[model samples]
Target: MNNRAARVALALICGAVFGFGLSLSGMMNPIRVRGFLDIFGAWDPSLAFVMAGAVGVATVGVRIMRHLSRPVLDTEFHLPAARRIDGRLIGGTALFGIGWGMAGFCPGPALASLPLGLPAVAAFVVTMALGMTVHDRLVVRSK
Candidate 1:
């Protein structure tokens, strides 16, 4: 009914759509991801199209958002303006890449594929959540 409620609803819908898309695109499969990551092996290039589509959609959405006078729910847009590269940013990105490369599944895909009842996917999701909690409590707190 209110603007904030509408925004929240929209966000939920968007997230559901994204998760569905990831599932539909086979991005939730670690095997598929691993295949894509494997350069010399049986390389699966399907995820490239998914990544490209997402980037295109995000670019357009960002442009549209920037052109808007103000956010529908909030008085100001909550956009990150950090242009400087810092150690935390680099280290976090490297860590994320290493984990993704090693496991062949990121958080979204791991959670999305949990319905398949794969033990590895389940374990990856659980460990990732635990790592996030620990990072939040220790690394974030210490900073």
Candidate 2:
């Protein structure tokens, strides 16, 4: 297949796998996620294990990939180049944390939960897209 087709196929496969993993780990459930975040209340520790497993897999994967001269499907791994944390980064992170704590749905789990056909999740996704568009136009383009 062509390069574009290969990239699209890889993205789809990766998304499917990620969604399935989130569902299987109960991360798609807002209640479960909120419970995990509620340390002062009836907190759940199950998500901690899930996060640990994900981190472990990622650590190993990154280490293995580091030995390779280049990615199999790409010329190079497009890792983040930014090292300095600026005000924009801090503000964005705070906004994300506030949204996640309030709605109990980060972008990944929110998108994964979209398959359930819930109005709230749909609204969240729409708002997320709008936020991204605004940020892209105002912040990203300005920079």
Candidate 3:
């Protein structure tokens, strides 16, 4: 109906499609994810195809978006202003990688797994939220 409502509905549809794709591709499976991360041992490469497909799609999307002045839903194309790598970026990336490797689920897949009603997923989500809150508070305090 309204612009905001249409944007919200579009977001919901996009998220649902993303979650369904993650589930269908076993990206929501911790074992499968860990297997993909494991290179020396019995590794699984199935998710590589998924990653490639996603990259391809994103590449095309980026190219297409070049012709547009702003996003379809929003008035402006919001992007990160930071262009240089810093210690904070390095540390955050390392932390994210460590968490992903240890838990076998990044933010996207972890959230997608929430609908499955798994205790482990719930714990991961809770801890993830707590970690995010702690990080935000620490950043604000440091500032």
lDDT of 3 by residue, 10-80 (tens): 99999999999999999999999999989899899999999999999999999989989999889999888
* lDDT ranking from best candidate downward: 3, 2, 1
For candidate 2, what's the RMSD? 1.3
Q: What tens-digit string does per-residue lDDT give for candidate 2 at 1-143?
A: 99889989999999999999999999988899899999999999999999999999999999999999998788988899999999978998999988988888999999999989999999999999999999899988987
lDDT of each: 0.89, 0.93, 0.94
Best by lDDT: 3
* Stretches > 4 Å off in candidate 1: none
Candidate 2 colliding pairs, count: 0
Candidate 3 Cα outliers beyond 4 Å, as residue runs: none
Please give the lDDT score at residue 35 for candidate 2: 93
Top model by TM-score, which number?
3
Which 10 residues in a row give candidate 2 its minimum summed lDDT?
134-143
User: Model 3: which ten-residue window has the lowest total lDDT?
Assistant: 134-143
By the TM-score metric, which is better: model 1 or model 2?
2
Clashing pairs in model 2? none
Query: Between the candidate structures 1 and 3, which one is better when assessed by TM-score?
Result: 3
Q: Quote the positional error of residue 64 for candidate 2 in Å.
A: 1.2
